[model samples]
Target: MFSLATWNVNSVRMRLEHLLRWLKLRAPNVVCLQETKATDQEFPYTEINEAGYYVVHAGGKGRNGVAILSDKEPREVTIGFPDVDDQEAKERIIAATIEGVRVLSIYIPNGGSVGSDYFLYKLEFIYRLREYLDSYFDPDQDLLALCGDFNVAPEKIDVYDPELLAGHICFHERERTAIKLLKEWGLVDTYRALHPDEKGAFTWWDYQFGAFKANRGMRLDHIWVSRKLAQKLKKAIIDREPRGWKKPSDHAPVIAYFEL
Candidate 1:
């Protein structure tokens, strides 16, 4: 059995203490981190290397970074999509192969607002991701698990108040359509597959207006498995306790267990 977790740390430097504490407790076999908000030069590679894991990171200046950490050193590591055509290489995706399984960490763009340029970029990012996945669709290659802060609430149940957030970027129709297109490409939401009827569970809470205290949150973080590995899924859950810690990130970690 292997346990994998995905978290949007918000800022790796600011949350290092919280991460160390969580790592000491849970000790997941693999961790996919998003929104690191630190450049490659700024990442504390030596510190993480001493934590008994191998790390693969990709990040740009102040936003949108992704990384993968593995208990056993990965055999291969690739940062960003090769098909991105140089124009979209802002460091948002990273993939590594550990014990034969392919783990991908992605930090999808958070569309700033509806019908804005940032929103268009977000959609284009998804399109690029689709192209990347299409290049590796062979089932015989390796089992794949894709995860991170997708910045998307997939369904109404994913948010506390759907109607109140009708046109919001995370819950808007265009974003949902883009996500649907990806799902149609043979990826399964491992968490939702395991808990088909569960509700009121969320992975992100706003830092403003006491959102966490009120339990008003959105399920923005996610774990997705290829159809080949979905059958091996054992469990998936959101660790909300981390969000309650002092100076915690607005996002919490989502864990998934699989029988390898």
Candidate 2:
């Protein structure tokens, strides 16, 4: 079984110690990260490589960034959605082929509000993702894994209280629909597929207002797999322990195993 994981580390630099500790514990074959909040030169790739992984990143100044750290070398490493023309907006995507499986580490924009420009941008970004996947990948045949913070909860059960959070950024209709369309295109949420009846199985919580303590959270981070890869799925898990650690990221790591 090969193991892989995704995490939105908030800021890789600040959380490097925690991340290194976690890596030592889990030691997944491939790890994808989002919200690294560091430029390429500042990503601490040397430290990561010393930890037994080769790291690749697409990043800049003080915001969104994505990275891939793999025990095996990655080929065809790409930094952003090819079709999206905006080159300076934010670093949100990184992808490569590891052991024949296409691994995409993406940080989908967090829609600021229900009816805001940022919200529309988020939707368009997701749509662009769909377009990219359709153009380059065969979801039914290719062994593809999209692992990162998707920012949208694809189902009512994915949120603690869908009614209370109705039309909210991550729970909005359009956002959910975007994930719906992606799944329809032949990808499946690996966690949901395995734990169909599980509820309140969240991956993120607000650091404010004791949200994590109250168990008020949303399953924003995810590991989405193509049909062919899903068939090889062995296990999917959200490691919540990291969220309670010192200077945590407010998001947990989601790991999946497959008989690759």
Candidate 3:
């Protein structure tokens, strides 16, 4: 049995204390972190190394970053989408092979507004992501997991208030379409696969208006498993209690356990 977790730390430097506490409790075999918001020079490599894990990270100045931490050192690590053009190659994706499983950590663009340039970039990013995965498709691989903060709610059930959020960047139709395309490519959403009818389970709570207290949240963080490993999935959960912690990130971790 192996357990994997994904969390958008918001800022690794600022939340190091919180993360350390959580890691001590959960001790997941593999962890994929998003929104690290720190450069390579700024990451606390020594601290992480002391925690008994190998770290593979891709980060920028302050906005987007992704990383993977593994209990067993990965045989290989790759940062960024493989086939992306130069423009989209900025830090957003990281992958590593741990225990024979290919793990990917990604932080999708937030796409602030409907018609904004960032919004277009978000859609284009998904397109490039699909293309990159197409080239790397390997059905023979028995364990492949992609986990991250996709910055998207693929269905109305994913958000607390879908009507009010319709056409919003994260809940927009275009983004949903892209996500659906990825599903068609044979990746199963492990959480939904376990709890097909579950609801009101969310990973991200907006900072404004005391959203977490009111339970007004969205399931933006996710774990996707290739069909081969999806069958062995044991359980999946969103750790909502972390959001209640003092000075917590807007997002919490999503965990998936499997019998690999």
lDDT of 1 by residue, 176-224 (tens): 9998888777888988998877778899989999899887999989999
| Candidate 3, 1-260: lDDT as tens digits | 89999999999998998888888888999999999999988988888888888898888886888889898988778877764555334578888889888999988899998889988888888888778777887544657898999999988999999999999879999999988887777899999998887788889998999899998989999999888888889999998877888899999999999998
TM of each candidate vs. truth? 0.96, 0.98, 0.96
Off by over 4 Å in 2: 88-90
RMSD of candidates 1 onward, in order: 1.4, 1.1, 1.3
Local distance difference test, per candidate?
0.86, 0.92, 0.87
How would you encode candidate 2's per-residue C-alpha lDDT over 1-260 as one tens digit per residue?
89989999999999999999999999999999999999888899988999999998989776698999999999998878775677643488889999999999999899897789989989988888888899999988899999999999898899989999998899999999987887787898999989998998999999999999998999999999999999999999999999999889999999999999
lDDT winner between candidates 1 and 3: 3
Model 1 TM: 0.96
The model with the greatest TM-score is: 2
